[model samples]
Target: MAENLEPTPVDETSNRINTPFNRRNFLKYTGLTMAATAIVLTGCDDDDDDTTPMAEGSVNLGTGDVGILNYAYALEQLEAAFYTQVVANAAFSTAFPSALERSILTDIRNHEVAHREFFKAAIPAASRIPDLTPDFSAVNFSSRASVLATAKTFEDLGVAAYNGAGKLFTDTGNGLTYLTLAGKIVSVEARHAAEIRDLISNGDFAKGDSGIIAGRQIVDTNGLDVALMPLEVLQRAQPFIKQTIVATGLPTQ
Candidate 1:
């Protein structure tokens, strides 16, 4: 999630969770909504320029093993937040039409929360990223299309993220351990991706170009799945994060 508050809250500001999300705002606001009316007073600025300035606060994900752990942690936070919203919404039952469908999503939600918590416990307090704010303003929790589509994006991104991180943990002694855990978690993400894709369209699960979609594509032609550098993953995931996710120090691919 983006970390800065616009000079003033406007019509479309995004937000994160409520357990004092301050690395930015602690409790001044809730959810991913802009107190648009608050900014209305500033509307009368006479300046001819109309371009919006980029947000200011930035969150560094750190470097080395810690950075990669934080990276995975950040993503789990996003997925957990998104799925939590889905299951809590009154429209949840309507969105999934079948008990099996609902249960699957429920299971996925639990899995995400577990993953999020795992990272929180695995990483040291000083190293872990703050609980992120999610900006799913464009998502319609009640709509089946919207929910499944968004789920697809998150699961697929999670898989690719872990895939790319594998090579970074090459500290042979501990590398195997990290890769093992990541492998186990990503396999779950892959399953979730396929499930969501099939829900979206039975045959659409692996239909996209190479690694972009949930298929067997690899870091290369061996068909292992796409591997995104930390920065690349951050760019794609940024829109959903209300907090700014800085990936500058992570190892480059």
Candidate 2:
């Protein structure tokens, strides 16, 4: 029987549940995106003519499962950076009226903070993949529409990432453990996705009504989809991720 599960609130101190996830083991975005995008753009232009390059050694996140864990750690870092900026510079204008909006975003920030810290704690060795720098200049932090749209994109991407990466850790020692952890976070991510989408248009929330959902093709998976290749994920995430990723022992899905 598929057990009924209540989604854990990011703001709550506990997620004590009777499903695969509970506070005990399982635990844990984006206007943050334009802000991040700006940082990346500026950083790229800063070093105009440094040709001297040093030999860069691969930061081994270990083989098999270890590598997978590190992969997640890298992603968490990106999410954390984006949300941190959103929280740091939350701009509510007169047009956007909702005290609840700020509160909800704060909850999201806390969750992202927890996810980032969790990965850092779980994989100490891989945590050194360089702190990611974000660019938010493109966003008029003064506008609520820009912030929520960017937030929605990030929330959806995060869910897709987990859905796409869940199978890669299949043979590792803590494979099941990691999957459960992913499951826990994926639910929260999905909620964020829905909320942001609703904020855009409740009728279009998680659907194809809005241009964002209908325009872009999305393949949905309950974490049972084919695992995305490391190379592919890296490519999509490259623009936002400035860190060097060294991966090994990842299986083809």
Candidate 3:
């Protein structure tokens, strides 16, 4: 039996459920959480030349902390777009007939949207990357298997992406603020990944036999989640993205 995973509002202090988790609350929470580290840092000197030649249609994700933020922004854009379509598809009802499943997907959709918007607002306009166009042409949203598989791919990829980029953040002042932010988001992403995995198979949530960890060796023998380089992550993500992403400006160390 699927769990009743409806989104419910909660008192932050008392932990009592109230109303549904809406966009306003989402933004308010994220805003308050990020207030201290919200200062937008300037691009690094190495990435000063934004005009550095690239593939005809490629967009460079500027260097330093800004570059890393753009990389995360790009992925969030992809995820938000994907979930939006999943819920809006004509066959969404049939694809996920169970009310519990529908609620889960809907909650995930709302979370992804909030994440996308948060990045957009967090990054300064001058440094933020353009809204990306996702290529979900191959996703058959009408089929539960197809949609779940795709969702699994995305969630797993998101978790690894954050894990990979966490160490790349150079702005660690104020109690490792950037890493703290990344940790917060990545924890949510990991939960989504686990939920989607369980949805696919009854008890496959934390198994290391599949997804990016198994395929890319991102998980270590000691049961630690390892990081992937920005370039590697972008390469795996390119097929789903319409715009060419240039990550050369991002930190390789």
Candidate 4:
């Protein structure tokens, strides 16, 4: 049986200074409630597709559109967990002394949590993947550079994952809904990637020769963002994830 992966509530009273842009404000300002309500109203009509059987210990991400949603859900779970830990760490204040930086990070945490919940509501319970455990041992949360670098990795990966997975949705009835939602969310992730890059270096947001975003290899010669297959994305993400995710039944072409 899979564990029900509920979003962990972020602690309001922490060592860091309180910010006005909390999760509630995020939902209200972004109209996330209405969006989620719409998903809930229309997300369950599609039936679950047949999934390939997985190894006994590994988790199967399901098949068809559900697999893609599960894949997104798994990634969101990781991002939300990472940001939650970043804001809650004992050295959070010392690592990021700038109030603006702290506020921005907090807002990102809120956005990620909302994204996680949105997928949870969008995918039917029977098709949703289990809560994944993250392995952040490689990350030195106390160090500013370490935290920012990890944030860059996550944000960039998220954008690329959505870009890569968008074409795989084949369900004519609900595919558009998922694709539109993905577009909206990926835009936010791209913003986060840009913000983190700028924070790392004043003008490193989208700098590259002839349009490619340098350093991360996430952009191409045509100025388009890199799109990776599910297996490839999972391979890059596996280090942060403890669970062995078997991404079967996802479209290859």
Best TM-score among the predictions, by candidate number: 3
Say which candidate scores most in lDDT.
4
lDDT for position 3 in model 2: 18
Q: Write the per-residue lDDT of candidate 2 for residues 1-253, one digit (tens) a residue.
A: 2111223332222211111222322242222222322332222222222211112623334445555656666666666556545544535424246757766765776566666655544443322343444444455556778878778767766776777677765533322356666777777787877777888776555564333234443433452322346656665555654334545445547
User: How does candidate 3 score on lDDT?
Assistant: 0.72
lDDT of 1 at 70: 74
What are the per-residue Cα lDDT tens digits for candidate 4 across 110-147? Answer: 77877876776677766777666677889999999999
Q: Write the per-residue lDDT of candidate 3 for residues 13-132, one digit (tens) a residue.
A: 432212233556566534435453354342223334452325665778888787898899888888877777777667889999998898888778777767776666677766677766
- TM-score for predicted model 3 compared with the true structure: 0.82
3 or 4, greater by TM-score: 3
> Residue 55 error for model 4, in Å?
5.4
Candidates 2 and 3 compared by lDDT, better number: 3
Query: Could you estimate the TM-score for every candidate?
Result: 0.74, 0.64, 0.82, 0.81
Error of 3 at 233 (Å): 0.9
- Residue 184 displacement (Å), model 2: 1.1
lDDT scores in order: 0.66, 0.52, 0.72, 0.74
